[model samples]
Target: MKEEQKHIEALHDIKDMMNRSSRFISLSGLSGISAGLCALAATIYIWPVWLAVREKLRTGGDLQVYPYPATDVQRLLIMTGIVTFLTALLLALLFTWMRSRKTNTSMWGSTAKRLMTNTAIPLIAGGLVTYRLLDLELVGLIAPSCLIFYGLALLNGSKYTVSEIRWLGICEIILGIINLWFIGYGLVAWAIGFGVLHILYGALMWWKYERV
Candidate 1:
């Protein structure tokens, strides 16, 4: 009996060790839901204000009242960069804290480090190129291009993470194609694709996976 008990304890130990070695533990559904909701709220708050500003520029009579088109594009890019960076940083810190609380392990693991590095490279390169293209007014199919590449990135990295994320990428690609039909609403499409879809995915993930 004692030998059997020892064997059971050893098995448990091995299981625990395996769990510790696994990646993707920081993917908490609750965290996803919270982040998504935050995105949605931010979109709701910002989009109208942005539209109002654009409308003012359109109607202000003074052609020079608005900055140069290039200046406006640069400003938009900078704002987007700041917002994206802050979102990433905030999520990272939140996940790190949560994971530390749950498992006495460092959140900055090889998997997360690799994931961030891999994801950032293509995105940064594509974003810079897209910005230049937009500045040059070569925006005939920029929205679709961005969507396709972003989806590809997500799909490529999905193997290291959750399967749902892969589906999200596919959906993004589809949405991007749809956006081509309404090129005038590119900003709205982007906001919906990223902000709305995130909330929906996060809520579903939380409901199905995280809820006990």
Candidate 2:
């Protein structure tokens, strides 16, 4: 019995070492929750802007959100997106770093580098394409494109992180594709995709891995 137990313990240690080498396992669920809350706040703040846009499209007339001209609506959305993204990114990095410290893991290890490389490529490409879309005045497609690209980023880097992220990526991709059929409901899509999904995923992750 003692020998068999020793063998099992050895196998478990090997598995742990393999996982540590292949993945950045120190990510905290709080990162996702914080990002989600930021997204939801942004969504709430931008709901009025979305309503204004809808009104403008429906009436085919000049519209403005208070002192700004109709043309400024897109600019306003872009600014909001930038702020929310930066804030979320900052919070995510902070939480990740803290978790890495707690776990005594190297936050900037080779696995993390590979993960960032895979994720950043898709994100940078998406940002450029999305910018072009904005310049071309294809605002309706912006939400779906953002969702799809971000999904690709997550999926691309998921091999270097927890497997749950892959499912999140898949869900984001599916939601983006579905949003194509409901362009008028882009805000709704964003709310559910970025806000609700992140919160749910984070909560699940905490329950599964961080509960102790």
Top lDDT model: 2
- Largest TM-score belongs to which candidate? 2
lDDT tens digits, residue span 1-212, model 2: 99999999999999999999999898788889989999999999999988977866747632221222366776788789889999998999999998899889999999899889999999999999978876666666778889999999999989999878999999999999999887767788998999999999988988888887
Tens digits of per-residue lDDT, candidate 1, 169-212, equal 88878988898776545556666666677667767876775565
lDDT (0 to 1) per candidate: 0.63, 0.86
Candidate 1 residue pairs in backbone clash = none
The alpha-carbon lDDT assigned to residue 39 of candidate 1 equals: 54
Off by over 4 Å in 1: 1-22, 49-77, 103-105, 138-145
Model 2 ranges off by over 4 Å: 61-69
lDDT of 2 at 30: 82
lDDT of 1 at 154: 68
